[model samples]
Target: MAPKEEVWNPSVETVTPVITLSFYFYPTSTTGVVIQREGFAFSYSEEFEQSEWVAYSLSSLDFSNRNFNRPFFIEDPKVKSRSADWRNYKKSGYDKGHLCPAGDRKSSYKAFEETFYTSNISPQLHEFNDGVWNRLEQKVRYWAKKYDGLYVVTGGVLSDNLKSIGEENVAVPNYFYKILMTKDGKKMIGFLVPHEDSEKALYEFVMDVNTIEKMTGIDFFPKLPDAVENKMEKSNDYKEWSF
Candidate 1:
């Protein structure tokens, strides 16, 4: 199950890091390159035609409480491999899933629009996209509102020789992972959800950062002092985030 062909790139263009993150937290990738965007930073796996991870911060102020007209998904000119055509998703019976969800950027129209970039999306099962996955996103918003702010990194779990869709060969991941931590890094929680729809409580999917790193091979908060990173990554309690 060899990954698809991708040229080696040591780096990609610059974008600002979230408050809890520094350049050091950026995941290591040779085939998957990093790109910073208005609201998030992600490593693009051209091999899978999707992002390996997308990281961002959500603040109470990030929500304007305005109705935003959703926009069309468009190709990201910034992506050198060129982002997948939105057409690949047409009639594919999958949602053009967002890595950086548009709702999180409702603070500004432009911010919301920026999320429409194709590079920010992947194929997702419709039931999953609108079901438990959607509920998890809402929980993130609630946590951000409660704690004032949070740093989050999320993406699908990629494996070799996976199934793909459309003419572009976009990969469909079996599972998705999201890690949430407070601004001061007091508490951290992680979740792994199957790509298909599920009725189980979100808490059922809770995991430790250690497990996510092991599964994805991406160091989450490397910029934290070694001691702090070690302690935080080792904790897996979801009760601290009780809503």
Candidate 2:
């Protein structure tokens, strides 16, 4: 018989304190399989609550020796704004800025590069991205060391229309989010934090995978039953997550 196709399910778990999140593992054509699900919603402070962006180190995730590349085709025209020009911003000695650092998952250049996907990016000041956000990515790695792994989704909320420099047209985020999961198949946890530089503007509130899909109008883990989604939303205790 042909090899059976592998499947995955969201595994919800609670991290330190009262934080609860969801994540899942899926087969990948190149990497054989990868963790590809995340739970959490990103909304304006006035619209939804926020959370803090913690840092994780590459060493903690055991990816210190791996090579990785940024994701291709990551650009959000909507991320542009009147406050600063892209070209000027680049020349100003600030990188395009990735909320999910490449170093965290440096298994391969492809994996590392995917971190550049516009969907996973935000217009953050160099100091913030390189400093605070970078630290958060490292901290996540530390958590991974103990838990064995984590699947995270993070990004910023675009509240205004800003024009792209070269095109002179308003920019819109092709995807206003970034998701990462672990290859190991134990517990699954995800997070969604804001791109705003202020610590106060980060991860304001938390929600489950279902709530995230509802808020974003996107369908995640389509193979899962409706009851599964429902359960994730209602239960604060993540142990209920199952296939």
Which candidate ranks first by lDDT, i.e. highest? 1
Cα lDDT tens digits for candidate 2, 1-243: 733444444353323211113222211111111222121211212111111121222224335665443344443232222212334334433356655566654644544654443433344556567655665666566655655555554544333453232232223222233333343433333334444344542233234545445444544434345565454444334342221
Evaluate residue 233 in candidate 2 and report its C-alpha lDDT on the 0 to 100 scale. Answer: 40
**What's the residue-level lDDT of 178 in candidate 1?**
92
Model 2 clash tally, residue pairs = 40
TM accuracy, model 1: 0.88
Q: CA lDDT of each candidate?
A: 0.80, 0.39
What lDDT score is found at residue 80 in candidate 1?
95
TM-scores for all candidates? Answer: 0.88, 0.49
